[model samples]
Target: MRENPTASADRDTPPTEWSVDVPETAAGDGGSDVRTSNDRLLEQYRRRSRKKSAVIVVIAALLVAVWGYAVVTGPIPVSLSETVSVLSGTDTGTAYQVIWNIRLPRIVAAVGAGAGLAVAGAVLQSVLRNPLASPYTLGISQGAAFGAAFSIVVLGTGTTSGSGPILSVIDPYLTSVSAFTGALTSTTAIYLVAKYKRATPETLILTGIALAALYTAGTTSLEYFATNTELAALVYWKFGDVSGTTWRFNALLWFVVAAVTVYFTRRAWAYTVLNAGDETARSLGVPVERTRLFGMVFASFVTAVVVALFGIIGFVGLVVPHIVRRLIGGEERILIPASTVAGAALLLSADTVARTIISPIVLPVGIVTSFVGVPLFLYLILRGREYW
Candidate 1:
């Protein structure tokens, strides 16, 4: 019988890269090279893991240093022991009051906001698969701004004294309530629009841009029709002040930050699998849509709480996570935790500069973060576009 030409040609063609190879070892064991290759890859991962751990430790140390600087800093420099004394309730008088009543709360709020925003940014970036998605970058802050403005100008949630958005003696957070509602409203609206349009990770960018513009217009309209008192209230609140933070507010924010961070970290492995592509993730048994939805909601919740407490601070999200990624690489296990620490450090440093830069006249931390972030983000884009 004549040989089949098609079978001959098929046999003649070289095997594809997907072809399996099972080589025998000198000891007669099969597939030793494959095992060796996998072993080598695992070793590489281990080395990288150790280095990542070291980097996190260093960043954590830096965060502690920055926190310390924030504490003892101000017009009257405080000693570490003095700070400890006030914290321990052993100290008394002027030093104690300044550190305890004012400085401590401010420091706590800055750390909480920075850490929360940064972690939120990291989660959003991972889940959305977009390098630029963050509360501030994607209009969460604008939504929050509108919400807060509505409370102050539309709902007349401004303090009864009518000077500003200060808490009344009886109602410590009349304005805060409306702001939270506004934030959640913004989050839900954006999520729904994106979902209705069947937005991919990429198309959601447009969703954010459109919503930001709409919210900004709403805020502007509110401002235009406001009374003088309401306008001043709205204006100051929009500046993103942490100085107004009470201990009660700080406790609430810290609790949210802790809860969200833990939740995100626990899901880091799923997020890592997701980076391989949704189909690959599904093959690995990941619940792609549900995880994405939960992540967005939780991240938005964290951002909303921080925004409500601190006004509309930005950039900690946009800048910190990117920097952490560049320094450490994309594995979410490291990225999430390290970003949290770096974020706290970066914001505390920024807050320090904001307080002292134009001495006796503190600028809003939001402005400072913008100044710091814009230049840095520009540099990153220009210099390391490949990294993204």
Candidate 2:
């Protein structure tokens, strides 16, 4: 050992590898702090999401329940069990006939119209980024009114003679066709304006307001020139009604609403991205302008179908979407679907109330929707503009 100095020195030297000995308390505290923070954030998110979902579900359920009660226990006073039995096909009495044949169709129409309008409103608001945007706001309703009026005043008269026999042969289908054409015309005009302006939100809103006013004036002039009977008919049409809609009309409405809903839902995620900003969406590879155009066209189509079927049922499209947005975050994914459910519930309930409140003399469903929807909407607006 004495002869090998280098080996001796190596043996005497301490190990070069280093090791850190952390204090147990310090390590435990840091880990606990990190986990606590994570847990708090996650819990907060869960609470928020749960609250939102719960509110939507509760509101929808309440609406349906109240509507069901109203439908069963009206002036005619069918029992709940009887209503259920009729729906299930176990009962076939006169009561059942009344319920199944008359009330059911009206209910279906109300629900379909409500859902269609609400989704249309949501699409318009998201695309335009304007809370005020709605089916009526864009002149689609007024345009439809003009078309229907034109058919009743111009086409109907031209097609028929003053002779009772000849007038009796005039087809109602012609009026429907005219209304649809007017809706399409308005839609095309709005689309062109939106496109020419690069689909900017402000441009679309301003264009829609101008066109709506124009269409309204045109409809008013048509009404002014209409015969007394024709004016009465036009006036009734403006009030809106689901009472006379047949199953065929309901089926058509459902098909259109379903198709539009599917198309919109498919692009919902992209819509969420678009809401962040056009440049942001473009940067993320979303076709911002194209998506906006598609949304507008699809919404317009839904509005056209609804207006054609039930005349100008106002406020459903404007009110439902804003209410839904307050419950759910502004994400289109949640907003669109929620609006669909919420709108249907609201409209169905309103229709039920309209029919039952006056007993044998049913009020127009549109009147009820506007009466309830306008006050609620005003309250929301007064409370805060940013609620949407």
Candidate 3:
């Protein structure tokens, strides 16, 4: 009877099937959601990269446009069609002479000098980790100035012809050599201090100030004893000009600039990592002291060459990098090249204005830059903490 009851109960309870409902997320939908999120993020990164590339491309285009404008612009008039014709060798007239011999060289010189100095400034700011560091502020230009002044006064390498707003140098080569010598000397001193004495950036900056003062005093002493013509010539040379630059000179300057640009751009990562701090950079296998010293040497070399060839063009090395950094952020890879192009454009624009601003008077390019740079520099200083 018991067996019959148990069997009947089991049969009645029966046939109950157990089932579990799995969530959709547990069915791998969560992984799919994750992949979708990753895809979206990758697309966003690509878009940003494309935008940044486009910006650099746009800046390059603007530089080309400025170059074209500069080529056609001058005391002598040349139309766009004529410029193209001249370039194509189809037209060999007065426009050709002016554009080919006069304006083109000067413009090209401006471009090379601007790019060189600007890139140098960028490197200095990064490696030295000083916002105020530049060829000018660091006394390199002043050192070059003293060299040129000494050449003019002591070495008797300077001579002037043509009076009243006209300047001619009898021996630009000798002057340039002396200027380079002086600049290198200054670089050597700085390097020695940085290497052996282990001077901090602040101390080096003070050294620059002292060197600047010493050089300025030396220049002044030379100027005090100079004849009036020599004085005028010295003043004119210090005014920073690209006028009368030859194709040969431009070739040399451009070659140096291109080499330096390649070097600096390739080392962008080093400079960028250096910005994290010297100790951090050293930890990352970057030679902190060596990088700083060599950077100064190369930067000073470029500055000396530019200054020797074109005179003391302040603010290009000092201001253009700061301006470019503000536009593109401090990523040295992009910053260096952008500063190169922007510097060329800015100096060319300033040179153009200098040519046209006072008409026949033809102000010094340095003066125009100073007029623009001083105000811009002040403004940048006021707001620089945001970027630098």
Candidate 4:
């Protein structure tokens, strides 16, 4: 036993090769705290998504209700029951004439115009990274105004017997066509500056400002030399009334709005990426410049169509998208559609108030929207960077 010291030491020493047996829970779950935190985050996201969906549904319902109410509330009162009956083709009387001929077209125009402009504003704001970007702010509306003014003053598309709301356009088509051409001209200018000069978003806005001034000057100059009748007609046209829009015009407007809305919805993810910043978006496989340019063009096109048809309904685009963002976060997929519906509601509601606010005197929807929009725009400005 004394001679076998090595064997004795080997028997006393522990084994060098050993393996740890990790618990299945720890291996599968990583760690309990980490797993719980991940689950909480996921749940929060889902809850937020659900809340946004709920808000959208509420807005859609509001739109329908507002539409019905608008059809009923006009110069000649029509009950909701009568409204329903007329729509169902069960009764055709003064209510039918009012709903089908006058109120329906105007109300539909408001909805379509509002939705189109609002979606355009949301897209422009996202792509340009400018919370204030809108058809009115970007000079597209002003361009349309100028085009309309040109039609009235130069093209003699409008006429008036006396200085009153009785002013009428001789050829609505020519006026709209002229307005579209003007809007296209302004859009083209912006595109060129963006493409050739490599303008920033801020620069493009400045270009818009300059174009607006140019168009305004042109319009003012035309008004200066116009006859009294022409002046009256021009002034009324700038008020932005949907009361005069025909069914044909509404059809065209809704078609454009629907098509543009679809395009925006499909490309919403791209817009969300763009909102993250141009460089970040580029890194994420987005064609930054092309997307920006196309976004501006499409947004401008929809805006142009609406303005051409309904004159200039301001702040529907600017105010609506911001309101939607506050409700749903910066998720464009929801933001675009929600803004569209919300915009329709806002404008329709405004139009309804405009009709009844003064009883006999119907205020221009443009005026009402401005009254609302100006305060909100100022508030957003005061809120500074956080508003976005």
Candidate 5:
């Protein structure tokens, strides 16, 4: 009798049986095989992610400790123990008052603003897929500046000359409102421009840059025509001081930060899907256009609030996200939260250095952030080019 083809093939291959019931050799088994493969891959990824997260947490803790030390042991030279005691409300003295009341709020402001701007930057960069994208690059900051300048140059001057009570004549609330309005307006314009032919990254970046230039020019013209006292006020505002921020201001800052953080964090999953390309995201049931629009608007609102309070603190949004991306990879789920923490630490350290580098003559927080951010950003660009 002639040997059967299937039996002959099996026997020639190996002594091991190749039955249809064999788990690894079964035909029409692709679904199960794929599931197994995916399960293994996912487990490996989770393990790697856990290790990376631990490392990041340790690094962040160390940085925070260093920043705290710098804040305390500045030009004034307060001990670490004394700083902790003061912060914890167990210390009582003029030194405590100065640190707690004056420096503390400034530090808080820096941390809050830095984190907010950084997250905004990361979101925009991922959504636009453009490295040049940032809060300023997207025209939000310029729009905010215009609103603030308008209020200071026109409304502020008008009220100052005829003021009975400063609060009654012109409220800071109005300035913030104007900034928000301008920010939304600019955001809408950019979105409309970018959405013309399917929302390409290049188109969005170009539109943002064009609108930013226009807003900046408008702000400059306003500054030029401002009255003498208004000019002085506007100059101070433009430098982005964190000094003299009150509890009320801090509360407002906290509220806005919390709102933005919660909103972005919830959308972290959507952002990750979004980074995978619009077509892919849409195929997977993501409303690509809606998600992008919502994220941009929410981020713009945050930027507006920050600029309204602190003036134009540039580069934090641009620099912080790139740094975070390098540290944590391009997954927005990780990038968003990581950027927030890293940005806060960076700004806190910068603020500490700024205040102590010249005691009683503190530099603008904006100046300090840029001083540190620029060199780091340049290094990133060089490294990024090499990587590419």
Candidate 6:
């Protein structure tokens, strides 16, 4: 049998009738008026919560549909069954090579990167208590971009290819490593400065902006020194396309995405408490400052790894979570996963359009997302007349 959630709360509430005339609506048919108002409101919320859960399930189904669409419709449209056959190793020849070696990896990378950015944004918004807070808001993307540029332009780690009498294939590993290091350094700088002072929203955000400006200047300097070939490569990477993702990089991206999602999802309760404000969180025995620091740092790590592999996709961390919050409520349990799936779908869809819209002259996935997000975000805000 289903249990009544408000039963215990009703029992626990003290009589309030002697103090003031109880509102007629406060009492139930059972005449249990003591806590009926609050209990009834909570029950109403529970009903709405159930509805939101159903919505989340539907959103998850949409993610699957988007994934299927991504897999089948490309430059050479492969059927879903054929794609499955290729994956299952029952198919052979050029079809398998094209799907497995190219389309599949890029699709997977797009989904993973989008999901990672969305989840990271959710975490940052909760911790920072700022609607605008995101991976980019804290300068993490710029830092990662600067690092990738350093490796690409200064070190020539991923750009020394298809030139001269002898082709030189630059090791992609060094570029990834440098990008990670630069991202970590920027994040660590923010964390350290915040810890030394206080990890308040204002302090962390200010520190991030400063670091972002520094990184941007450094990147500009690097671009000034770079040869035309190097500059072109750097610009392409910064445009945030997921076209040339190799199996090795895609594998690592998936690993990080899985790990980050699991970590954040498990800490869902802590995030809820944190969102309630520092004093309330402290009252609930949550380590407010430490939790905020961990959330920001890990979120930054995910963003860095993604930008390292896929370049600097913006507004994902900023837009997706807000969209999730708008569609679903801000309960961490639903918000995190829903944002992730929605984000994955958004990016994969954007990447698909990027590849096909202009035909051979593929646009960057980032550009597509930005073009789409700005209008959608405005619609959401204008329609609601309330911030997410």
Quantify all predictions' global Cα lDDT against the true fold: 0.78, 0.76, 0.80, 0.83, 0.74, 0.79
- Which residues of candidate 5, in runs, are more than 4 Å off? 1-40, 157-172, 197-203, 376-388
Q: What does candidate 5's lDDT look like per residue over 210-298, in tens digits?
A: 87888889888987997766666666677766664666667787788778878888888888888678899999898989988998888
Tens-place lDDT digits, model 2, residues 1-388: 3686764788768557868733233323555665666666777988987777787788778767866766675567788788888888899997798787788788888888888999999998887677877887778777776787687688872232353211221344565567767777777787677557676555676777787888889988988998876766666667877776778778888888889988888889888887777789899999887888888778877776676566788889988887787677687876887898888888888888888787887888889988987887677568746634
Residue pairs whose backbone atoms clash in candidate 1: none
Prediction RMSDs, each to the true structure: 5.8, 9.8, 11.6, 9.0, 7.4, 7.3
Give the TM-scores of the predictions, in the order they appear. Answer: 0.83, 0.78, 0.83, 0.83, 0.81, 0.80
Candidate that beats the other on TM-score, 1 or 2, i.e. the better one: 1
Residue-by-residue lDDT tens digits, candidate 6, 45-121? 88988988887788778878877777777777678788888889999866798788878888888999999999998
What TM-score, to 2 decimals, does candidate 1 have? 0.83
The superposed Cα distance between candidate 4 and the true structure at residue 167, in angstroms, equals 5.3
lDDT tens digits by residue: candidate 4, 134-216: 88777888887788778878877777755366456667678767877787788778768866886776688799899989888
Report the candidate with higher TM-score, 3 versus 5.
3
Tell me the lDDT of model 1 at 381. Answer: 59
Which one wins on lDDT?
4
Q: Score candidate 4 by lDDT.
A: 0.83
Model 5 TM-score (2 dp): 0.81
- Which order, best to worst by lDDT? 4, 3, 6, 1, 2, 5
Weakest lDDT window of 10 consecutive positions for candidate 3: 21-30
Once fitted onto the true fold, the runs of candidate 3 whose alpha carbons sit more than 4 angstroms away are 1-46, 156-158, 161-174, 188-206
Clash pairs (backbone) in predicted model 2: none
* Number of colliding residue pairs in model 6: 0
